[model samples]
Target: MLHLRVIAPEHLREQVLDVLRNEPGVGNLLFYPGVALLPEGDEITADVARECVNDVIRKLKQLDIQHEGAITLHSLETVLSTRAHHAEEAAEGDAADALVWDELIARTREDSTLTMTFLLFMILACLLAAIGVATDSSVTVVGAMVVGPEFGPLAALAVALVQRRARLARQAVAALLIGLPVAMAITGLVTLGAEAGGWITLDDVKNVHQVDFIYRVGPISLVVALLAGAAGMLSLISSKSGALVGVFISVTTVPAAGFAVVAAVLGDWSVAGRSALQLLVNLVGIVIAGVVVLVLHPRKSLIPRSVQPN
Candidate 1:
């Protein structure tokens, strides 16, 4: 069960409340048209897990009474509103309205940009990840994952695919395809120098084969990518950003890339290739899953019969 709180002007309060009440799985609907105190905690309406939050906002715009308002949606750990749990509701992409693919693309644009911000973040991320892999420190690897800016490009790609923004889609794909390889190659060259200097030896890195066993190939990496993609998209759209944690957890891109770089340094091509393959699987999985999800879930009617506009 999700709880939503909406803050709008008193005059249009009833209309907003009515619309929210009509939403499927939305219960305990309450609106204060006249109350004038900022409520505690976050507004639940903002977190409302709808395929098209934009539509709801559009409908609310008609009321014309909104001064300053915010809505928040909370995923209840245990929703007693019905037998169905939040996870089940979430998994089904169950929402009151059908959201189109373009919405996801627009959302991704909100936080990410195509300029230098992308390059700087990724470089830093890859550098850190390479250091982590060479040290055989899982802690550093996780840190690199957190640091990597790959999620922004990934989310952008998913959004573009769903919305059919051909130009934008091509750009995003190019970024993802080109960004990691370049970064990894740089890390690899640096790793080779580090190894030759006796700063880190093959004994330290070679034993990592045990770590590569699981992620070498197959479906697990793909599954991680899919989940990461979904979580990354969800994080982009959501107000609370709880899913960011999931995004950080699900993507093996940084770790694998770092491992591959480490292997490159030690001249261990087999493990390097396997790790690179793992990273690829994860990337493909996330982008495909993100696109599929947005395609499946669509937003509400942008055009009403009476108010059709060209």
Candidate 2:
């Protein structure tokens, strides 16, 4: 179940109330007229079933409440009321299968943005990966994987493509194209500096054992990426963040990029090429898998004809 707090303008208060009253999946509705100071409107709160949330939010959007006032959605971790149980039973679909499009799009857009924080995480992850490669440390590589922010844009790109949002797709692609190369270049420079400081020697790179797999592009790498991508998409839709973290650690994206950078710095063009190929394979596999997952579990409209926009 979800809790919605809506601020509705005076003119739209009656419509909002009517919509809430008529929906079987909505209960515990409360209205406070002229209570919203910033928006200068009525404050309305209701508990709605997860399956019915998208319909309610879409109806709210059609009323232009998002522009004139505000709407906030919150998940209800524990709902002990009989009304809540009835609401869930009355809802059209299962809560676990629900896909809140508005929330998903907003989250992906925010994550895909090339912010300073994003760049910092990417650079740091790549540097960590470089060090892991040099020292042949699987633990360090996993840490870099967890720190990497590349999955956001990659997931966004898949979502954009599935939604047919060209602008969002372009933004995601741009972030990937620019962010990966920048991360790699910065990692390369850091690698050179480390060698100069005698922090990493050629022998360390050549003798890497556990981390050497990062630079080896193989069929297994693609399969792992595909599996991770599917798991990542499932985690996003179901809001299982812990599963998403596992997905991050399961893939070798950051480590591959880091390996490519260090290999190039050491004039190992063959290793560098293979690492670059590994990165490419992972990116392509993840995106393709994400799109497939979204396609398989589509968001269906449940809004009433009277409430739906023309």
Compute each candidate's TM-score over C-alphas. Answer: 0.62, 0.91
Our model 2 lands, by Cα RMSD against the true structure, at 5.0
Model 1 is weakest, by summed lDDT over 10 consecutive residues, at 39-48
| Candidate 1 Cα errors over 4 Å, as ranges | 1-103, 110-112, 209-215, 298-310
Clashes of each: 18, 0
Positional deviation of 94 in candidate 2, in angstroms?
Answer: 0.9
The TM-score between candidate 1 and the true structure equals 0.62
Best by TM-score: 2
Q: Rate the local accuracy (lDDT) of all candidates.
A: 0.62, 0.88
Q: What TM-score does candidate 2 get on C-alpha atoms?
A: 0.91
